[model samples]
Target chain A: MDDRRVAVVVEDDEDIRELMVALLGQSGFEVHAAANGTDGVDAVKENDPVLVTVDLGLPDIDGYEVTRRVRRFTDAYVVMLTARNEEIDTLMGLDAGADDYLTKPFRPRELRARVEAMLRRPRVAQAPVGTQAPIPTSVPAVPEHGQGDTAGQAAGPTSAAAGSAAAAPSGPAGRTDGSSADARLVLNGLVLYPHVHHVEAEGRDVTLTPTEFVLLETLLRSGRVVRSKAELTRILRGDEPDAGTFVSESDERTVEVHVGNMRRKLGDDPRRPRWIETVRGIGYRAAGAAETSG
Target chain B: MTTAPVIDTDALGRLGEQLGDPEVLCGFIRRYEKMLGQRVERLHHALNTQDHDDWMDAVLSLKTSSAMAGAAALSQLAAELQDYLAKRPPDPVRWPVTDCLESVMAKLRHLARETARQLRLFLNRLSASPQLA
Candidate 1:
């Protein structure tokens, strides 16, 4: 168990599910594949894998619910996959106990890097003498490993078998304020920094205009649902609170034109988008969620 | 026959403080010249070929490039040019396009030269504005 790292991939699509498993397996992870949310929950409960990736568009239970459920039972990293590449969905995913999210049709390497970054985080060891953890004092205390009967404890052969059991009392041991300094978006090998406004693709920095940088950040933050052009313009300009919605109609059109230009600079394809994708009648979203661990 | 440049470095440096990276001023100078040159070259080709789509593309690129580089005056000028072209009836044969092109090109060159001079005084030497040259 300690010799290998295990990652659970819960996706309904046969091809995507198989692809994820193969990708993770090739990247030095023992892959556990689940077809739906229910099976995924069961697999995590049994496997105690170090990381789990859940797709939002599950056939049975929604992916958000799966994240919530799994979060309650284990400390394994939960990365949600959503098709609605909107800003709200990205925030909501974080609120639902997801460590990170990536939109569908993502790059295999990005997904693999996210999993590795999550695993590399030091799980908070049971409150050491000097460690400052807020574990509730009221819960009946169990030994160092944890309460054996606690639902959080999984019984399966651990992914990295020897002693890779996740640390107790999950809740992003090393993260703070829902943001990591090193947190960044990597799509199709393009690295975008949220705070720095820097983009690097194929190991070279791609300079973006101020507006382009703003647009990219907006897409990354909201890559789970379709963001209307109006909403985007308003966000960019910070228009009046109640000044009327029609003010941004022209700005809305500009958003599309600017995005078209941005796509050209990023070398993204609209016909078969491998990065920023267009939603027929709605708006644009970052299609790739495969982020590298910065 | 030089006219007073429209870009005021004092105002730009103040804006840069709010925008972070004082070097964005220099960035504006470099990018505006590079993009303006490319757009002018492209527009010349588009005009020769009578390609409305190519013309529009050139104008759009110029507009966005200026806006991003913090060349507010130049961007406004480009926007006006774009609006005029977009709103005016197409007369491919009688287009007074050369006049508009020369006017903007001259303005941009003056701005670029002025910006370069200001960068030398303020950024490199960290000095106040040079007395009216």
Candidate 2:
């Protein structure tokens, strides 16, 4: 029962697996890792981690299948590790319920920065209600071990885990609506609670990965104005949403996949979508969204 | 006149840092050395037995392992082998397949030597680092 957030890395290459384990460990996550799909799923179920980074091709059933099974049970953010040439699978991966995709031969710093950004966006669903996380709520601050900077061993989980876990309620900082995370956004029958990052589609609870949640939030906040894939990736990258650099085309595909999955979770057909509408080569927007933020 | 770098020392150095210990990197090098032989043999076995699926799997594993060990050039070559094997011939012919595998094998042999040298250099750095000790 480690109170620190958990992360599971499911990659076949030992080098990559070990790298993930080390990277996540240093960044305050209690990391569990595996070399294949079956074991990867097993670890996911056993740990119920807040984050799970999976490789696209595994020794057993491949990453797409692993994410499928995980999505059926838990909503842990699934980041797929893909080879650069396997850009095509990025779509397949999203269709299979991956939250994000990382090209292989990735820079360690880039991975860390990406993970940090993802962790910053709250994971209210995994916080097991009736618990209060400290300020800097979503991402625990990076630990600085006694030794000056990153020299020798990094202080994994110590500095980040410094927040006292004894508080009573689970809620983000300031809520315009109320103190109990009742911040709600409505798009007809679809309902989203901004504070807790909760979503309910047509009376049934919809399990959204962190990336999906952010995408949904961005669309809702933006109203009906069309957002390009470049804009969305910029949002995902923790950059100013309106501003974007040269976005990769694969990034656009990644958005398509995620939006596709999000639609499925909302039980909306792409043929004639009811909740999220695709703008054809532009990006996506929430259908008839009405925001009432306090 | 540029000889394509067999191994990316920068990648190797980054990997060494991620591993946190040069000795751990040395361990991977040893395992990679052994796995390369086994994977190459497996590829040959698949090709000789006309097991295209198995051959694909072997080459993919080789490619990933090469990338993991920072053998970018070799990994690229293995990826080419993967693409080539993906195009299955209707008739299982024993011609040219051996030639293709041999070329990849030659590259792998060169990469293995380069990988060994890089690991040696990384290990020496670890020994010199008072902080690591």
Candidate 3:
């Protein structure tokens, strides 16, 4: 059996569907295509693809519902295809559990790049088949920025995050450069299991969509270093939507909305944040891990 | 008549590059050719039944399919028509289409006819180009 990654492209247009399939093929995925929302959801269920792209104007059901349905059972990185005019579609797609939205008529290179960047964050081992993983833990309040070097070191660096077995000497593993793919990264009671893309806080599992998971993981990896909105947006957009794509201001809104939704899901109070901290006119910094070397 | 090309062959070539071959281009053209008749039938039904929603679906579908096929002028016209009808404002703000529904529908019918004629011309051009063939 080929253990290569799987990808599902859910698009109505035959032209675009084949485009997506070819792109993923070049990216080392066993690709599948579906014509509508119903079959798209069914394909995700059957193939358990690691990545999925959905169109907003699907015939049977809208893409939002498709993302919602897929999220109910899988943690695939869901990217929505939307027209440039529909800002609401982008927002709704993210809220409906999609990790990102690719504007239609996108350069095929952008698709490949975004997928490559998303694939970088790492994944956790899936639970046994037919068994649901434990419900997530409550999100603990993050520590104050620059005040948690001890916690950061205590969490371990490159080795800790690269190892999948949670039974290691240190907490779950998470690296700063995003070069490692270890199992879990535990920051005090806040645990990020990268292999399965699960996050836990205060002994409870928290259900974060792939985008939120990637955003939070990026913040956690960076610790006290203030990651600018532009930097974060680039991460959200994958490496190179820089020049040809829209300005950073538009991307700032994208990050803002995803961050807003992530905070709500984590139940972190924005005013008195326990986990992620806000810097005025700058960007967000994960309060914990002040001495992040990874 | 010296007219601007409705279907951009260069754009269709792009679609081919994305799909890795020209077969997809030909296949979709044929498929859309068939789908177009049904969609027009829906438009006729919409007009007979005076169902705005059905009319909306037809226009929207035509807009999307034309856009996918790289029917630039037709797609732009259909998109403008759909937007104008859906918004139903006093004036055309976003697009350069007429604000009247009957006018928009008339344009749609005209564009559909022209697009079909252009598509046949494009098919002939494709067969003649040995590289595309």
Candidate 4:
């Protein structure tokens, strides 16, 4: 009954997985480590973690498939880990139901930061407004004597927090400034807010997970213009403008999946889109017809 | 890298005069219907739910869509809405919903009525045009 959020890190790579577990653990999160997709999925069911970071290149089942499978039974925040910086992989992860994506060789501090950021979003009460609380699941508390953490917990010792603060600007993550303000997008009976990350359709507030809202808004803002896989990855990942992580430009089907999700929510037909039009061989576009269909 | 058609004034104006006609206005009408109708619907939904987050999202969308369709009044209104909503802890009083939303919808409907009704007049008279060529 600790109620502290738990995190499950799934990866075949012992070193990376341990690194993530330690990183999360230091932040006072209960960490579960899974070496493969099947184990990872089972761990999620058993632990019901609030967050799960998965590596895309798993030994048995690929990370993308694992993410898709996880979506069926859980709504945990999923951050996909990719070794190849391939834009397609990032899109695939998002489409497969991942809430976020991180390329490999990422800073451990960045991972901890993402967990905290995702946690900070005010969760809309999942249970209907004021019935009986659902059965409470057991949340494991970190043993006070445990030494399995790194130096970057958000509210840990001052020096450790300082190190992360210093590393943040240089890390391959995007930070929003108040100056740029919130972003807005209108497309085919849909409205998207990039700043707060919200969406609405046809005068009815549509519930979109954070990832879905971001993906849809990004596409709408780009107009009917097709965004390259790499471009969309940058936008979604919010990589530092000058960060030098190697990014693969090929493969954009992940975007297609997000587009497909958006289309479904907007009541557009996938095979024949009236909202997000498919651009063969390049990317997707928001056709004018698609926007006004409703 | 294949280049997209230049949407600049040089390109649009040239294309406008060359296409001569109905296609230009017809295209504008069709595009406006989608863009404006969607924007209004989104705003209406955002406002009805009192979902401040969704309201900002819809307003931001209209900001861009209005500019694209040459609905100066609506574009400016959308921009105003976006700016107001973008401010953290947004103030609901500042939204220009009554005039801007109604005007945008009306103008869009008017534009959609005919294939070509003073296309230049519509584009030129608007105040919130996007960066034109």
Each model's C-alpha lDDT?
Answer: 0.55, 0.64, 0.64, 0.52
**Isolated chain A TM-score, each model:** 0.47, 0.68, 0.69, 0.53
lDDT of 2 by residue, A1-294 (tens): 446688999987675677678778778888999988999989987886767899886778988888877765565667888764555677777766676777766766778877775554433333333346331232212212232111111112321112212111322222235434445677877777654445767765565655677788778766777878888876765555565466777667677777776777678887787777888878877677556643
Error of 4 at A225 (Å): 19
Those runs of model 1 whose alpha carbons end farther than 4 Å from true positions after fitting are A1-3, A127-294, B1-133
DockQ of 1: 0.01
True contacts kept of each: 0.00, 0.12, 0.06, 0.00
Runs in model 3 with CA error above 4 Å? A13-29, A105-113, A120-191, A194-196, A201-204, A234-250, A288-294, B1-5, B17-20, B43-58, B88-103, B130-133
TM-score for the first chain of model 3?
0.69
Model 1 Cα lDDT, one tens digit per residue, B1-133: 2232345555445544433433334444444554455566676677667676567656555554444434455556656656766676676534446777566666655654554454344444332432211
Docking class of 1: incorrect
Candidate 4 per-residue C-alpha lDDT over B70-128 given as tens digits, one digit per residue, 9 for 90 to 100: 34445455555556555555654444466765665454344333212333444553324
Worst 10 residues of 3 chain B by lDDT: B90-99
lDDT of 1 by residue, A161-275 (tens): 1133232222221122223333456777777654333455665545443345556766765655566676555444433213354634444555676677567667788998877
Question: Which pairs, if any, clash in model 2?
Answer: A176-A294
Give one clash count per candidate, in the order shown.
Answer: 15, 1, 27, 16
Clashes of 1: 15
Report the lDDT of model 1 for residue B50: 62
RMSD of 3: 8.5
TM-score of 3: 0.72
Ten contiguous residues with the weakest lDDT in model 1 chain A = A147-156
lDDT at residue A88 of model 1 (Cα atoms): 67
